[model samples]
Target: MSLSLVLAALVAVTDSATHNGRAGQTTVPAVRADTTIDVDGRLDEPVWRRAALLTGFSLYQPADGRPAPDSTEVLVWYSPTAMHFGVRAYEPHGPVQATLADRDRVSADDNVEIQLDTFDEGRRAFVFIVNPLGVQADGTKSEAGGFIPGSNVMPGQNDLSADFRWQSKGRVTEWGYEVEIRIPFASLRYPVGAPQRWGLQIVRHVQHSGYEETWTPARRASASFIAQAGKLVGLAGMRHGQVVELNPELTNTAAGAAAAPSGDWRYRNDAQLGGNVRWAVGSDVVLNGTVKPDFSQVEADATQIATDQRFALFYPERRPFFVEGSDQFNVPNTLVYTRRIVRPEAAAKLTGKIGRSDVAVLSAVDDRATTSDASRPLVNIVRLRRDFGRQNTAGILYSGRTSGARATTTSPAPTRAWCSAASTSRRCRRCRA
Candidate 1:
């Protein structure tokens, strides 16, 4: 027989063996006992099927003690204009309490969160998190920081809506729920390309039963989806339009001055104008920068008590200059050097991929104040890093500072150094003697 015929027959046999637990059952034509099946062809068949089977793909789940109904099956589909999601949660028990309260009223019991990460495969992506009660947790159009506190719906801030529906059958044993989400293409941003993979997670809260089952496995219950997410494949031919953003901010600050013995009130105000620019540099890399970035619009840090008696309280730098992915430039085991580096008022960043390696670099002039003091002299830092795949990297770092004259009629002295290294290990070894 022809090779194509032989391959097709073998596929039938392999599919039957792999999918034995599924409902379907089939047999393949018997072959010679000594025959060795082509292993490459067998592996290629399933991969192609996985890439092609865009609709009706169910998220894989391992055997665990989580209460998963035998009839529970999730169905997912996508279109050009919007992504369509449907879930057929077969609750074998009687009809349970499914309420639609304000998003802020979410609790551990009987709640569901639908999270979407547009750029699932890359470092930067937009995350949209919504609960069953139409409450949104983090609705930012970009990746969130690790230290930012979780956000609940604000009072009188309820303009967003989620198009959802459901139905019940018999008792809690045979109930069903369905949700149809129409995420506008304009409202979302994702890297355009063929075979786009996305990180996704779903959490179901059974309030009455006090149970929570996550679609993606996670080590911590409250961890963000970044650390724990499953892949959504077969996203070829997806495209994103120009990213347009409009952010207008206003600020008013007042302070009162009081003498030690007598108390008196004095008022002062400072106003500033600021905004950010986001433009796609080609398709994969996104260029982001801010002019006079303002942190007054951002929320205050969440309250926390310091239990440790030895160390000072931890306060992350809230400056906008540090928020633009600058922390990644920090050199490991060199915290003092990093802290002394002058923060730049103007910066130009280049990030994305050049061939197989991921490249990121930041070039900026250090602020004047940080470099002025001799004790904690501020120095300009130019951090460059290129990942050579899986633990391999090449980096070049330069820092310098000019100190003011110690006495009259003298010029400032300059201090500078260049550090370069290449490493296959986790830490970069200084190559310069």
Candidate 2:
């Protein structure tokens, strides 16, 4: 099939699923900033005064889709470097459940959240949330099959592990609470273009009353509520300057081992240096490479299973290189698991968009998951996906493995053999699990 035709089919499927929800999306124009935003949780500047307000909230909790009793006002403005928001959440009766929590630990507190589908893809979004005390929690959301989340308690659309640094501040006032948030363009990923139309949603969570409301009513029955969210119109002059990242890390450790239980153990030193580089090839593609990458866990996992299992358990990806954009891969049976690549000496990954299609490729060599030098192998994965209708994707995947488990092995030797296969797969993730 022609490339254009394939993309068209992808879009058709996605649009169909997303369109099943409400229609006549709310639209708001983001004004260009004329003055500075102080970010003190106060909207006293002229920038906010000139911004447009988006209101008309409806209840999503305590009722699937009922009218909200309290009032809310959302003002939006943007500059070349960042987007700004001024949110006023009015609560008349109850005391705000503000907490002095650490950064990225403020969601459970009485908070307000802004979900931006910067690419306007609906299935994916960058979520910025801040509590009344200004503590913040951010994450990424992926909606497959454009599924509307089943319940508020376990809203299945967000990957809270996907966090980024952004600016936010909030204050509890006499009537309610207000928030000011600034998200840098560099911290987000969006197609570079002007006159941009992005999907957006504003939500307020009241802890005292267990109230949930959205500026644009997010219906329960609709599978793709966020995908079918209100639109942010008139976005212009958006530029995510040259994307380049350089990260370097160093670690030193000492370990001791004894031949016998009572033998005096001798200590050995282990020191290593590692780093990675990320460079964007225009706005559509990103290239990442790492040398001697260290995939050590900073915090130990506390969750354990005592039962005998028929298959290996699943744990979320955490390594920086593998976690980013990891969701777009749709290889059948999840053939690509980063944790399996026990000790990847080096690795490279490329991800971007071509026309309406999503593409990702990864190549690495691990010397960890096998027996000895003879069986070491290389791993390569490629995924191409197209979304045509509401919240579904049709994609193709190719995986090549030289041998053994993902990476565990005895010696640090290079891989030689490789087996390859290609297959087609369909997946719908309407919300995060």
Candidate 3:
């Protein structure tokens, strides 16, 4: 097939799932900043007056569908290259729970959370959280797939293992606290060059009162959390600058040994070249690949002492290449597990949205399996999901592996499921083949 035709096929699946503001869904207008705004935890800029204001939050925890005791006001706007938010949390008598903690480690403290489904896909959301003192913790929320047994993951929990580049500042005041956030378009992957509609939800955690409130009425009766999110519209003329990342790595090691009873000493040095590359294809799709990539983990995983457990232990994936777009590959009973491709020699992946469909294609060549070094296998995975109406999705998956003359492929029948995020664990209300 021609390259243009292939691209068209990849993106032109169907527009039936296009979102056009659900019935009774609240809408928040996103204005373009008219002046320069600083990120100093103060909404003193004149532009803030014209920015969209979100208030009248409804209680989400302790009791649902009730007015909150405290008040919170959020201002939303955007620049050509970035999105900005300013928030003022009002606390009258209760003390604020905050501390100077490391990033991605402040869930215990009182915090504010901003969830953005940039693609308007209920399957996943990018979560940005900050404490009163501006301590940051960011991650992604996967709502499409049900909870995996023995994965050490809780229901309705955000995976704090992922991090992104963003700017934030906060300060405590006598009345309450204020926070300012700026997220560059490059840090996020979204459709570019047109007006965009995204799902937005803002949450405030009142520590002393044990109150959790949301800008939208996210009642416990709701089936999906993202489905209850308000719509953010009027985001136009956005720019996702040429996002090209190249990580080049080199390592050298030397060994010395004595030869013939101290007659002579010989030394040999060995060097290896490896790197990873990522390219944003038209802001909506990303192409990632690695050549002899460094598979070393940047941080060690939390120690998991194996006890007599019914299921094997599951460790979180910390590799950058796999974690980048991992959300797209998530499905009920997760068909594609990247960690299985141990000791990868080369790998490439394509993930993002095309039209109203989420697409992911991955291929990897494993140098050896964990059980035996003599086994070299090639793995491939393809996933496609379409979203329609509110909180409804249908998808298909295909996985294959081949080694030498042996090959195996698994292509389950197309399945349709509507997932509910109301309880601690996600549940698929209906499933059909």
Question: Could you report the Cα RMSD, in angstroms, for every candidate shown?
Answer: 17.5, 16.0, 18.4
**Distance (Å) between predicted and true CA of 248, model 2?**
1.4
Native-vs-model 2 lDDT?
0.74
What lDDT does each candidate get?
0.41, 0.74, 0.79
Residue 326's C-alpha lDDT in candidate 2?
70
The best candidate by TM-score is: 3
lDDT tens readout by residue for model 1, 1-433? 9999999999975553332112221111111121112222011222222211111112223433333442333333444544443343444554455555443345532444445555553233333333332343323222222222122222212112222121111112235443323344444545556666665555565555455565544444332434354556566544455554455555566766775665766667877665656555554454556454556544466686889988544444434444444333444333312323344445455444444334445444445565434333324456565545433456665656544433226558985343443233233445342
Ranking by lDDT: 3, 2, 1
Off by over 4 Å in 3: 1-25, 147-151, 255-260, 263-267, 295-297, 308-310, 369-375, 405-433
Residue-level error in angstroms, candidate 2, position 387: 2.5
Better of 1 and 2 by TM-score: 2
* Cα displacement (Å) at residue 25, model 3: 9.4
CA error at residue 47 for candidate 2, angstroms: 0.8
Number of clashing pairs per prediction, in order: 13, 37, 0
Error of 2 at 204 (Å): 1.2
Best-matching candidate per lDDT: 3
